[model samples]
Structures are given as C-alpha cells and as structure tokens.
Target: MDERRNRMDDARFDEEIAAEVLPLNRDLTLPENEKPRTGREEEAHIHERKQDYAGIGKVTGIAAVILAALSLFILPVFFGGAAVVLGFIARRLGARSLGNWAIGLGAVSIIISLIFAPFF
Candidate 1:
C-alpha cells in the first residue's frame, strides 16, 4: 500500500511540473506576427530632454572673464567685484576652466588696485 501511494504522488508531481514548464517553452516560440504586448514599446518611443549645466556654466564663465577684463579699464573695484561673484557662480554651475580664469583675472585686478592705492 505504501509503494502504491508513492507511485500516485510521483504521478501528481510529474503532472504539476509539466503544467509549469510547458507553457513557458511554448511562449518562447512565439510567431513573428504575434508580438507580445509589453508596454516597453511605448517607453522606447519616449524622448526626454537631458539635463545640461555645462553650456550654461560655460556661457556664464565667459561673461565673467569678459567682465573681469573690462574691470581693468572701467571700474577696477565694481566690475572686479562683479567678475569675482560671476566666477564663483560659474564654478557652482559646473564651468571649471573659465570660472578659474575669471576668478584669477578679477583677483589680479583687485590686487593691482590695492597696490596702486598707496602710490596714488
């Protein structure tokens, strides 16, 4: 009686395994005309605008450099201050090279003004 019960359990387990495995293999062999309805196709068509801070920072950095250059001739105190502020802003915005240049130029202008103050 135990041997007979073991045979019945084995048969039930084999049926359950077949039920789970067969459908997966069948789905994998789908025809070209019968495409699966995954929502990924719609997702693939979506066009998202990427975030870009480099361009904005670069432009601002350029402006800072120009302002710093102008500071030498115009207002060494005021334009230099503006340039320094813009350079720091540009650094925060991601423009490393131009921001550094602007900062250096502004600082130089300010220092020159300070040096000339004793003579004048």
Candidate 2:
C-alpha cells in the first residue's frame, strides 16, 4: 500500500512540474519586419539623452545661482538651503562649474545673512 501511495504522489508532482514548464513552440525571436538599431543611431540616442541632462543641469545651476543671490537679501536660510540642494543636483547632472559657483554663493549668502541678522 505504501509503495502504491508513493507512486501516486510522484506522478502528481510530475504533472505539476509539467504544467509549470513553458511551451517549447512559443516564438522568441523578433518579427522579421523590424531591424535592430545601428551603432550610429544608438550613439545619437545616447548623445541626445546627454544633451537633455546637460540642459537640465544648466537650468538648475542657473536657478541655484539665482536663489543664492536672493538669499543675500531675504529669507536667507530658505533660499540658501534651496540653492545648495539645487547646486548639488546640478553637479550630479554635469554642470560642475556652475554648481560650484552656486554652492559657494549660497554659503556666502547664508553666512552673511546670519552675521547681519541681529542688525536687521
């Protein structure tokens, strides 16, 4: 009886495994009408992506600088903090020089504002 039960269990397990397996006849290849992208096309796509990032970086860097300048006049903590954050983001996106300038200006604005806070 034990031997018969063991055979039945093994058969059920095999059936479960077979049901889970993918069919061999399914098509895995791409359609013949579509061709793979050429190297130049790929490069152009990558270049375009880089340009987009650079543009974004430039914009962010400019905004950061503006915020830093604003910090010198009003709401120094808020504007300076925003400038610093945007500067770091711009740096990560490839505007190194602008990001550096933004960071420096932000820091200076914050410090100057704090120092003069008592007088105002």
Candidate 3:
C-alpha cells in the first residue's frame, strides 16, 4: 500500500514540475541575439536609409546655380528659369540653404539678362 501511495505522489510531483517548467524551457531554447525583428523596427531602418538620400536636392541646386552663372543674354533667361525650378524642388525636398542659393542666383541671372537685353 505504501509503495502504491509513493508511486502516486511521484507521478503528481512530476506533473507539477512539467507544468511549471515547460514555458521556461521553451523560452530558454532560443538564443538572445537571434530574436526576430518586428515590423516597426524594419520600418525605422528603411526610414534611416531614406534620410541618407534626402540631400540629393542639394546637387540639383548646385547644378542649376552653375548653369545660371555660365549663361548670358537669352540663355540666362532659360538657365535662370531652370535654376528657379530646381530651387523650388530642392526646397520641397528639405535642402533649405541650397535651394535659397539657387533661387538667389537664378534671380540675379534673370536681372542681369534683363539689364543687358537691349545691348545684346
């Protein structure tokens, strides 16, 4: 009778141990460094990459300024127009200083062309 009681107690204890330990054991099975990334984390990484390329407008603005400087007479009008457009785009894309410079240069080119239009 004692033997049968001891067997029953052992079985109950084994069941309790398994019930308490199964979840913890499962958690321990995975390595800390191998945890899966969530969707939000992936989106943040992509956003950082996008920011890295956001300064492309600065290049456009610089090119527009160069064109404006190289142009004279009728060409200055066209180059200045191009510079203004590029400046607007650059401003929209967050290149504040470059956009402002482009706009200023384009305006100066247009004024110069107008000032010397009768001569040319």
* TM-score quality measure for candidate 1: 0.56
What TM-score does each of the candidates earn?
0.56, 0.59, 0.52
Residue 112, candidate 3: C-alpha displacement in angstroms: 1.7
In candidate 2, how many Å is residue 43 off? 8.9
Task: Provide the global lDDT of candidate 1 against the true structure.
Answer: 0.80
Higher-scoring candidate on TM-score, 1 or 3: 1
Position 109, candidate 1: lDDT? 96
Reference-based lDDT, residue 65, model 1: 99
Superposed Cα deviation of residue 58, candidate 1 (Å): 0.9
Estimate the overall C-alpha local distance difference test score of candidate 3: 0.72
Give candidates' CA RMSD values in order.
17.2, 10.4, 19.2
> TM-score winner among the candidates?
2
User: What are the Cα lDDT values of the candidates?
Assistant: 0.80, 0.82, 0.72
Clashes of each: 0, 0, 0
lDDT of 2 by residue, 69-112 (tens): 89888898899989999999999888998899889989988888
Which of the numbered candidates is closest to the native, going by highest lDDT?
2
